[model samples]
Target chain A: MDRFERQHILSGFGIESQQKLQNAKVLCIGAGGLGCPILLYLAAAGVGKIGIMDGDVISLSNLNRQVLFGENDLGKPKASVAADYLRNKYSDLEIVEIPEFITTANALEIMSDFDLIIDGTDNFSTRYLVNDGCFLLKKPLVFGAIYEHEGQILVFNSAKAGGTNYRDLYPNPPAATEIPNCNETGVLGVLPGMIGVMMATEVIKVLTGYAESLENKILFFNSLNYQTYTIDFNSNPELKKLIPDTFEAFRAKDYSLSCETIPSVDWDFALSQQNSDSIIVDIREASEMPKLEREEVLYLPMSKLLKESKSLLAAGEVYLFCQSGIRSLKAVTELQKVLPGKSIYSIKGGIAAFLSKQEESNTYGN
Target chain B: METKEQKISVRAFGMIAEKIGSAQIQLIGISTIDELRESLFDQFPDLKNMKFSIAINKQLASGNAPIPADSEIALLPPFSGG
Candidate 1:
């Protein structure tokens, strides 16, 4: 009896489908929660070549959702451990362990070798990087993301015509500080299992042409309520403008850095310039808490600044901040467009980091 | 004749839900997606700084599309975790 005898016996999935799966080369980025299930299913399904890339080590905390590791696996690099586990289980399955993190410098090169890419990363910067690299490489990307109790899965840039890419769905990456990962918000242990399996299902469907693909649709599932929704997204030609058109341009881009359009100043630097000629603009909305009581701070919300562009025209060397650094970066981008050549910088980590630093230093009164 | 006020049911997910303090919200007098967003920003000011997409009746909406009466609106922020 063959190892794939059970699956091959299923209707419409025979030797041909199994052979297609065997010939398929899939690359899964991030060996954590989503990657664990995705890699497990793909390897069990007998994918010919599987590449697991992650720069993180297996920690005790990750065992709750990252099923690929155990107590003995702690302190081991996730990529190698996951690869070894899969390889030891299946001798024929070729698992490549890449212990390095994916960055713009190596994303395109590494992704170009695979037939399909899976994004299981936990940050906006890497998500965008993977999306852009897959788009450029013209490989179908199976994307999975999870929050507290909900998960989202999508298959982008497939061979199907009219297929939408990640950029079409999200033209801009959300600010890094705005969206908290499972580490911060906390996710149910089973959420990633459900989402990752869904992604692996998409990978199989795309590889074997066994079923309809989610080429332009995003499946959003909430485990808490057991409610699932599929939202259709259309390809936007304008979104391509955000991506680099050539490999040279892509190589020149910085994927590890978020919000590169504007310059950023650390909390220490921002504090040093507090009483200097640099004007401090609080871009957070009026209702947000942890207000800066300093007399030198300017309470100008982004909405007001957009409506009244002339208010900041006379202000020299403007510094922007918000709850997180994201809104402030957006403010810098907007202000730079109108006031070209002006020195505009967003305070890194925004007021949240600044307040924490103040508390640490016991300088709230100052 | 007395005019009836229009109200739309809103559902927020992930960080947007945290900011709104509830998974569900009610926006009154909002006739379009943009209006609903503005109303949400006014009620939950922190939403202005966050990035999210709006969906109406299970379809991702763009621009100032008119909101259907008693529409099921969903505010979805990006989910970065795996």
Candidate 2:
């Protein structure tokens, strides 16, 4: 009875729904940043059964936001350590640890056992693998991601009412280099924690049948501005391409969407756009381009655009640039969806290419 | 002979970015994985022994790629957040 004491947070759902949560099984992918918070809250919430899977080991850097382990846990496989932490910390919760990396080869078998899966994985290759596996298994997915100061959360799987998955939003992935890692551009320590907590909140919402949860909608947040925005996305026509009847068919399909995407030209265009007064607005952080030697332009990071629409530059022919053009493309896509007919182009090579292009153009022009 | 101080960029991603001070650093050092790590740890003490991977020019590299002057080197940690 003491275990059920002030845990009245779930009491509002009535015991039946809470029992649903307790009986539910969730398989978490990745034991890193997002996984830590989701696991912590789910275990604390007394989810009857939890499954943890990851191939990576604990690193010294993970201690900051992972918040799951101390110095002693370093160098150990994340799945084992994370499961051990949850099992010991919340002795009441039942936990299973799959200490293997979830690859395309084993994704189906691994995800089939769980009622729901959380995509805590960091890279696109794994995200696609997780998405395809969940789609095949027809299990609901709780998704979350963090950038420097921004984050995203969505839930999907046709089984759950109002649940829409990752593919509904991004039909394809960006080229690996198009998007830099958090290492390339530092992320606020609390950004992923905030997003991870939001994801955990979504899991509770789905399990307890909170009708107003973020279903079929992508929630975006800017930590710097403390602003949040939600875009209603549905079963897109594009997602239909992901449906595969057999494993081989699935394997053949270009699940590596980022690799297959059209090579972008942000840098070439940004340089030209800026040199010719084409309204060069950097969709990345201003700090990112501290030494940026652009002539005439504007600077509005993606985080800024997420909350405040492009109403300011809702003018003619705006050129958006980011680190690798992916963010700008994403920003432009989101913006164009909302403010249709606005002219916007993504700078392909980001600043690097643009600088080179500028130099080339100047060399010839001179 | 003067050892040219190659200004290579080391990009830190995910949790690894947080440990290595700012996300991107144009580190000035003799281009080599060992020297790069040495210089990085020399500046950011907390990152010592922090397990992470390095990528050069967007391609994953062994820890021994010669860091040429003004090359792009990225530091990656296991990112669990999708």
List of chain A TM-scores, every candidate? 0.72, 0.68
Model 1 C-alpha lDDT per residue in residues A63-86, reported as the tens digit of each score: 888998988987678899999999
Question: Model 1 off-target regions past 4 Å?
Answer: A161-163, A257-366, B1-4
Query: Candidate 2: which docking quality band?
Result: incorrect
Separately for all candidates shown, the number of backbone clashes (residues 3 or more apart, or on different chains) is 0, 21
Worst window of 10 by summed lDDT in candidate 1 chain B: B1-10
lDDT (0 to 1) per candidate: 0.82, 0.68
Best by DockQ: 1
| Model 2 per-residue lDDT tens digits across residues A1-366 | 546445555446656666787898899998777888899988887788899997666666677778787789776778999998888887777899987666566688778788989988776656777777777777888888877776767788835534355655555554453455553456655777888889888888877776567777656566877866555545755565766657776656544324333333445444555444357777765435323555566777777775666454545667776643456656666676666676767665455445555556888994
Q: RMSD (Cα, Å) of candidate 2?
A: 23.4
Q: What DockQ does candidate 1 have relative to the true complex? A: 0.54
Error of 1 at B56 (Å): 2.3
